[model samples]
Structure formats: C-alpha cells, structure tokens
Target: MTQQSLSKFEEHLQDILQYRVEKELLIIKNYPRIIADYDRDLIIELMESLLNNVYCFAEKTITITITLQEKLLIIYVKDDGPGFSKKELLTATEPYYFQNKNSHFGLGLTIVEALTQKHVGNLKIVNSIDGGAIVSAVFAIKVENLH
Candidate 1:
C-alpha cells in the first residue's frame, strides 16, 4: 500500500471507462481532495469490479462518491438500476453466488469484499430506498494523511 491522491485514482477510473461502451451510462464522481494510504492497484480493481457489475444492470447513470470521516475513507458506488433483491443483498458477497446465472461469474462483490478487508476496511451492500443499489467500502486511514 502507498499514499495515493484521489486525482490519480480518478484518472485510473477514466482509463477503465474507455474499454466499456456497451451502454451509454454516465459516471459521476464526487471525490474530496485528500490522500489515503491504500493499495492503488487493489483499489482500482475494486472500483473496476464495482463498475463492471453495475454496468450489466444500470439504467443510465452511476455515481462514485468518496468521502473522509474522521480516520475512515469511505467509497460508495451507486447505480440507477434495479435494486438488489433481498437474497442478493444477503449473499451478493459470497463466493460463486450469482444473481444472474447467464453472464456473471458471481465473484465481483466477493472480490470487492476481500479487497476491502485486505485494506483494513469493511464492505456494505444495500439498496437505496429511492432505487438502485449502493455498495460502500470503508477503510481505516491515518488522520495525518488527510490533506
């Protein structure tokens, strides 16, 4: 893990967006200007996995929000798709659990959970009462690292 600026992370997200054009989905990101100590590659992989999973079900827009509260860095990825079913909300992060048996291998959330935990973080999967699905990753960070 290394200290990384969110700007650099956003740049990586833009690069990931280039290869995905199956849907006309608009990705909106809200990130504060802060640095956190995290594995850059693993965070990127986590974001990619979140985005890829949402892409398969998102209607038009996806939002990525990053915020810092105290010593925790919180990353949330939300989609304008059908919210997860109850069963999915419970088992989505389980290995080899698939909501749709056709296209997905069912490892995306599982991977995200693992990556989050690896960084001393916890993952939350929930359905927005308004609509869509929201995945939140919260990581412990050094308070001094905030800039």
Candidate 2:
C-alpha cells in the first residue's frame, strides 16, 4: 500500500466495508505508517473487489491486516467464511470464471491480480487453518539507499 497518509486509505477502506457489511462484525487491525508509491484509485478499487468477495462468503467477521517489510507491502483480508475448494484456488483469478453462477462477473480477483502485476505485486488466496478464506496481496516496494 502506498499513500502520503496511509490512514486515509484505512479510513476509505472502513467506509467501504461499513457500507457493504451493514451490521456485520469487522476487525480492522491498526496499520503502521507506511509510505510507498501506489495508485490511490486503483488500490481502492482492488480493495473494494476483495472485500466484496469476502462479503459473499463471510459468516460473521472479517479481518483486515497490513504489514510493511523492507521491500514489500502485504495486505491480508481474512474472512470467517467457507474456504475455497482446490479447483477454485487454481482458477479463482481467471477471467469470466465463476464458482457461483449468481456471483459477479468473476472479475474481482482478475482485476486484483492484474493490478498487482501492474505494480509488481503478487496475489495469494489460501484457506486459513481456522477454517476461513485469507486473500493476500503482496506488493514489491522500491527500497531506497540499499548498501
């Protein structure tokens, strides 16, 4: 995640989630200060889609966490929902592939994957050991003043 003020991004995320989640439980882990280069609008769109997918399957709570490493930024959106099947894991990000017939265009993960690549990032979807889905978006950030 890149922002002049990352808190603004967090606020934006909370707004979107609050709107979509209605009265559901949401746990947003406080993020530390992180400054990097990123497209604000694109990040917002990416997060919106990710949250939408989580909302689709979430039962009660959703958790959002962000971590910044020396050369990477990782955001994990975890939900207490049914995890993905083996087949879904492989093709979830493929265009026009819908696990649920009534779901959205199946473009949520696709767009996220594309945006991640565009920013030299990676996307991972895994089933949490606690029996939920965890979607992680990892971005490579330029490290300054390397020895």
Residue-pair clashes, model 1: 0
* lDDT of every model, 2 decimals: 0.81, 0.77
Clashes of each: 0, 0
What TM-score do all the candidates reach, one by one? Answer: 0.86, 0.84
Residue pairs clashing in model 1 are none
Deviation of model 2 at 114, angstroms: 1.0
Q: How high a TM-score does candidate 1 get?
A: 0.86
Q: Give candidate 1's error at residue 97 in angstroms.
A: 0.8
lDDT of candidate 2 at residue 24, scale 0 to 100 = 68
- The positional error of residue 55 in candidate 2, measured at the CA in angstroms, is 0.9
What does candidate 2's lDDT look like per residue over 1-147, in tens digits?
344555566778878866664436555554456555666676778888888777778888888887666667688988888888999999999999787778777888898889888778899999999998899998776533322
lDDT string, candidate 1, 47-90, tens digits: 88888788877887777787777777788888889989999999
Candidate 2, position 27, lDDT: 51
Residue 33, model 2: lDDT of 62
